[model samples]
Target: MSAEASVAAANFVTAARSFVGVPWRHLGRARTGLDCIGLVLLAAREAGVDLPDPAPYAREPQGTRLLEGILGHARRVAEAAPGDVLLFRLGLYGGHVGIASVHPAWGVPACLHAYAPRRQVVEQPMDDELRAALLGVFRLPALET
Candidate 1:
């Protein structure tokens, strides 16, 4: 990454980490509560990227066309960097989303997401199994600036 990109990534990580304890709330956006996509939305806004709200979506992945909606707002990238949106195929359809963040303990890239099962936002390593399930890595257009 270029020096500017590196700095942007650092800024994104800082902003995203501040949301660690937010409880998961479907279709919500705010520090009080957030969903996986809400986490991404917050992080991107913090990074100075304004993205349009995706159209109304469902709780399930089967027909929401989540990935397709994201593609309209961001460009898919070959590799993930801090602040990139990571889309995961948790099932047959486009399933989950998260914000990429660097893991402090391992000094490697991890993902920050609002996990519904856990009922709160958490960060976890993007291990092999997780990587294989990734549908795409997308970067906001403003990140190029």
Candidate 2:
């Protein structure tokens, strides 16, 4: 990563980690609650990147170009550092997003996401199985330093 991208990543990680325990709310974007996409938007905004608002969506929005929409504004990366956005292929669907971060307890790489099943944001260990589900890794436009 370039120096600017590194700064953006650091800034994003700082902002994203703060939302760790927020309850999951469908279509939510506030600190009180958020969904997977909401978490990404909030962190990007906090890091000084204004991403386009995702169209109103349901839990399983099908046949949408959601992946293309995000990739349009982000830089695809070969490796995910703290703060990189992770796109996951959940079975047949492919719109799940998560923020990469260091696991607070394990001190290893993990992903922070507003998991609906958990009803809250949680960090999951990024192991081989998780990597197998990864569709792509991306970083937002670099933030001003």
Evaluate all candidate structures by whole-model CA lDDT and list the values in order: 0.79, 0.81
lDDT tens digits by residue: candidate 1, 1-145: 6778777767777777888889999887999898887777777678776666664677786744665655566788999988788888766766788888789898888998898888988888989977888888888666655
TM-score of 2: 0.87
Instruction: State the weakest 10-residue window (summed lDDT) of model 2.
Output: 63-72
Can you tell me which runs of candidate 2 are displaced by over 4 Å?
A: 143-145
**Model 2 Cα lDDT, one tens digit per residue, 1-145:** 6787677788888888888899999889899999888888888889787787675876786743665565576787888888888998766777789999888889999998988888998888898977888988887666322
lDDT of 2 at 75: 80
lDDT of 1 at 29: 90
Q: TM-scores across all candidates?
A: 0.87, 0.87
Query: Which candidate ranks first by lDDT, i.e. highest?
Result: 2
| Candidate 1, lDDT over the whole model | 0.79
Q: How close to the true structure is residue 28 of candidate 2, measured as C-alpha lDDT? A: 90
The candidate 1 region of ten consecutive residues with least summed lDDT is 63-72
